[model samples]
Target: MVSLICTLQDHRDDVNWCAFSPTLLATCSADKTVRIYNTQDFSEVPYSPLSGHGYGVHCCCFSACGQYLASCSTDGSTVVWSTDTGEIEAVLEHPGRNPVRVCAFSPDSSHLVSGASDGTLGLWDFRTKTLHRTGAVNDTTMVACSFTPCGQMFVTGSTYGDLRLWDLDMNQLHAEKNTHDLGVTCCCFGPKILSGSGTVQFRLASCGQDSTLKIWTVSRSNTGSCKMQLLHTLTGQSAPVLSCAFSADGQLLVSGSVDKTVTVYDASQGTLLYTLNQHERYVTACAFSPSTPLFATGSMDKTVNIWRVEDGHSGHVETATFSCEGRKLLCHSRLLVSDWSEEDVGAWLCEEGLQALVENFKANNIDGAELISLTKETLASELNIESVGLRSKVLRKVEELKAGCVCTGVPDEYLCPITRELMKDPVIAADGYSYEREAIESWIATKNRSSPMTNLPLQTTLLTPNRTLKMAIGRWRTSQ
Candidate 1:
């Protein structure tokens, strides 16, 4: 059931978007600035709002790692912010009158993808801070874009009521279909809702000017490949369904509408659960906490309401205030949102690289393409990804991308302090930092008994391989 936690006047103008990070909540507005609030330390008011765009900011997003914040504007530029210091790291601008509608970081925090009113999409490299790809493949003004949990598949909706799915790795269109009868305003991939046997079953929930919320059944094969099919079409909102989000466990779906209402549904059975009517104006956006039962909604009335999403049986428990208990809150753009599938690996690719590897490894499996099916961990550990040194192989590609480039220094996060080279085997050391396994091992054996980067006494000589970093390194290497 739905229960109000608290309401905050998050913006001076219509709050276009609001997302939670582990420690903060960031909101964007037509006022042309972004404000961030501390989740745990509410004693201090928010610092000065961030502003640099020529026009009102339309959307904002905090990278998965929570190290950076990105905001897009009607002026056609996106600014990346260093969250800790509230400093701008990069200002990304594209030529044309196409106002950016939304922006989001790939789950791995390796790429930033943005959609525009001109039906254009741009993919920017976060590590190198460069715009590497742009496309005008859609003819209608695009309304929203979402990357599936793996980042291999991308979904986009347009004003003309159509949806297009693309294979990011192949850089090829996967499917195009009409689900909404009018402008497709927003869409999000459902969380992994599983069956009794522990099998994954997910759905795509979309909202539109048509006043209908469409639920789609996403079917997949043994190989991590999948397809979407119409499952259930929910119609009850008195006006346009402005935005929607799935609970982290995929047990619930929450939607906001121009009717000034919020609806909750049993995601598995597609049954109405609860309806919240606390807003004075149109509800424009909604989001759920990454690992809690908390739900939040943003509206044109200039307030953000946080709610507790309980099971249908609980009815509603009134909550006058909300507490983080150390839970990081996150919110995002018009449609760009949290990862749809698996948990975010601290070091990772986007699904684009996962897609490429799946397709390439299909022939080698005894189970054929089905064996390449993507599971929760992405690829199962049983697969022979290590047969040929995966670390060294991908690291070499990274150096190749730097050949004759004009960027300044290499992104420090991706380099190994010991060797000052792109890391092939990244591992976490005792000091809660990452380093190239070989390089750090050598440091401990021959160099001083201190952390090379911080010069602190070594806590331990042990190093654990970081699988996430391996995948991310692979993606950047291949994309370049």
Candidate 2:
């Protein structure tokens, strides 16, 4: 089930756009400020309420590494802020000084593109903070932009109802005119790339004033030619779809609409999954977290709602649940890693492409439990494997096996009492119980000092970092 976890009401004006990094969420508004929040607990970051924009900010996006955030505004510039300290790193003035409507970072964060109200686009070299090239379309405001996964090309949508593809040099590769009856509002490229023979294919989603969301397949052949074909036209929302985003895994798609609703879809099949009606005003922006089963939607109601995808509802799978050939390997049909016999260990070694060490592992009688306990020292002293590279490879594969076991079994103690999720940063509260740091902090802030487990008042609000528990959880995670 999908549920709203929290509603952020920090913005005093309409929230124009929202973006998520690995650990932070940024929301821009017509209030002329950008706010940053900790994704862990939805608390405002200490350095939030970024006021670098001179005018109302229209859009914001995070760099690939989450190190920087770029925001564009009616000030006719895109300003880059350091995510670490919320300081302005650079200010890129859009060519022709037109109001910048949207901005995006390339897959590698090497380039930044800002679309303007005057139909002009500024391609900036992120490292140098300089304009690399400028391009424009006649009589149309450039409002939407997204970079393909390959980083070699990007797609732009305009008020003219056209979706145009361009290379890094600002040359138009293909233009799908009249993509929407009225105009395109937003567009995004899926994270995954499909390749076969001499062609590489990408999935692109565009929403427009026509009240429809369209999915298209963009293909680039070995001969360097590009083509775009419409794949699906989704009409899940009753009004104009203003924004759309693809999940990190590209398995799900979400869109915000003028009908004051948010729609989620099974992206691969273009089938509607859920229609959420929690916002009282037009939903203007939506984004998915890069590292979690969470998404955020911003609305003209001056709020941003955070939603979580429940465990089974999320279309995520453990990498270990599949064989090398991409066939499903049922965990119930095989022995757990901790219970595997010596023969099982040997077979696993072979399957991992360590056939040369199968005999060595068998000779050592390294059962599953023992395999989990193996260290570099054990490999060198006990197994007498002296090749450093091979030892490293084996250890890496073993770590992968451990990580694969996380979904099957995670220690209850390693989970936070409030969230019941594995604690990445465990801390001890005044109640003398360990919990996830952010989870407990948020709890104390909202529940008025009550201990989550004991149901009694906490004497103090102080929290101490539980280093030992954190290390233990880390090791367990590596072993899982």
**Clash total of candidate 2:** 3
> Alpha carbon lDDT of residue 8, candidate 1?
62
TM-score for each candidate, following the candidate numbering: 0.62, 0.66
Off by over 4 Å in 1: 41-48, 95-97, 193-202, 219-226, 317-480
lDDT of 1 at 195: 42
User: What is the C-alpha lDDT profile of model 1 across 234-331, one tens digit per residue?
Assistant: 88698999888887777788889999998888877888777788887898888777756677788877677777765555656464543322112222
Q: State the C-alpha lDDT per candidate.
A: 0.66, 0.85
Candidate 2 residue-wise lDDT, 355-447, digit = tens: 688788888889999999999999999999999988998887788567545523556688776555578899999889999888788777655
Superposed by TM-score, candidate 1 places the C-alpha of residue 42 at a distance from the truth, in angstroms, of: 5.5
At residue 175, what lDDT does model 1 achieve?
53
